[model samples]
Target: MTTEFLSLLCLGLCLSYEDDKENERLSKPSLHAWPSLVAEVKSNVTLKCRAHSQNVTFTLRKVNDSAYQREQSSAGDEAEFPFTDLKPEDAGRYFCAYKTTVSHEWSESSQHVQLVVTDKHNELEAPSMKTVPHVCNPRTAGR
Candidate 1:
């Protein structure tokens, strides 16, 4: 029966595709910020993405913000994205994903790395602290 043969062929093709996907799954990369996770406005920071393979292309994007995304290709396992003159608007959660040269499949996104931006003019001061100006000279213990 030609109808029965076609049904068996479709079933076989489905199983083959599933098997290929499982066998070719890529490992997720790790993302982190250098220098520190929190930065003051007008400062700089670098986001580092590490993957398991070389010659990979990495992409960076802000969480829940469609307007911001960056991509870079690396010859090694790690890629760096730098931001300078940071502002409050630049602070947010970010992650990265990578695609190796040998595969079209992109690795799952890396863990979220949070960036906190602060304004120097709005810095907090301790309530219980005070400063007094004085001129003094050192004296010997017996003086």
Candidate 2:
């Protein structure tokens, strides 16, 4: 009889855990879309986010566990983050989120936009001096 009681207790615990999981999933925030971009060094990269509801807010976060940055949108349609003087350190996955009610009910969306701050100097391949014009001796030319 003790064995049967233990089995019933385990079953009840499992059901409770499942219910908790379902509630967590239902409360998850949804992001509208993620933007992609490629920019040069010393330039600005704009991270845009959009939401479906009129009462929305914006949040930006790095791929790491750091706290998110929040911004206000005029129409709750989209928010833009200006990444000025972009550097290699900014190269990582970024995501956006929006809030619905004043209580800050939010939806989140994420995307990976690789920030490649290519130096213009590096873009221009150095002229290989070995491949440049060379004078040839007349005696060697005849050989």
Candidate 3:
């Protein structure tokens, strides 16, 4: 009888441990900017936040800022925040996070990604690659 009681106690402890693990915070989402980390003025980029679950709300925040830059409810597994007409003000360290629509707790912030913006001078096409001249220009081609 003592052996049976000890076995039952072990089972209860195992179950409790599992419950604790289940109650842990949500996993951190992966954040990445498309094309490249460095961007030129008047260019475009997308910051994508990928989470483990769908139907969650994603939030983008620039480091050192008090408020979130953008938030969206994503029905899919990832949320994209597009930055168009890039400017020097938009260049900074950014991170993202997400939480279930029904939950108040937010997942941990994603790894930060820096967006370096170059000067706003008129772009010139490189002498070599003239195909997509507008996209890859002399000023940015070296970057």
Candidate 4:
């Protein structure tokens, strides 16, 4: 009876360790944006996907879109996607996921991030300005 109990206890400990390793492997990658989350129109924006594991393929997708952007990294665990000449239509939510090359299994999806695009000139203008401000007067009171 003593031997049987020790065997069961050892088996339980091994199973627990396996569970912990699996949970770590299934962990999701993180997504980050360069400069800022809010970008101006016609500006460049870069999105980064970083995973804890190495030699995995990273995928970035826009929410509600069927298209998928894929990148593979052998040297590091991060991939970057750049958006040039951003427009209002580019504003949307994005997500990142990673898959191991050997297992071909994907990790859990990362948290969603929202990208906002605003007009550069309009952003510099005063908030109360209903119409375009005059060059001579900075405030909207004159217009």
Q: Which candidate is the best by lDDT?
A: 1
**Which stretches of candidate 2 lie above 4 Å from their native place?**
1-36, 65-68, 123-143
The regions of model 1 sitting more than 4 angstroms off are 1-23, 125-143
Candidate 2 lDDT by residue in tens digits, 6-46: 99999999998866644442123333222336666777777
- Superposed on all Cα atoms, model 4 deviates from the true structure by an RMSD in Å of 7.8
In model 4, how many backbone clashes occur?
0
TM-score of 4: 0.66
Q: What range of 10 consecutive residues in model 4 has the weakest lDDT sum?
A: 67-76
Report the C-alpha lDDT of model 4 over 23-104, residue by residue, as the tens digit.
5665789998998889999999998988887877888888987765556564578888898999998899999988765545
How well does each candidate superpose onto the true structure, as a TM-score?
Answer: 0.70, 0.54, 0.67, 0.66
On TM-score, the candidate that comes out on top is: 1
Residue 39 miss distance in model 3 (angstroms): 0.9
User: How many clashes in each structure?
Assistant: 0, 3, 0, 0
lDDT of 4 at 36: 81
Q: List the residue pairs that clash in candidate 3.
A: none
Q: Candidate 2 lDDT (Cα, whole model)?
A: 0.62
TM-score, structure 2 vs. true: 0.54
lDDT of 3 at 19: 73
- Considering only N, C-alpha and C atoms within 3 Å, which residue pairs clash in candidate 4? none
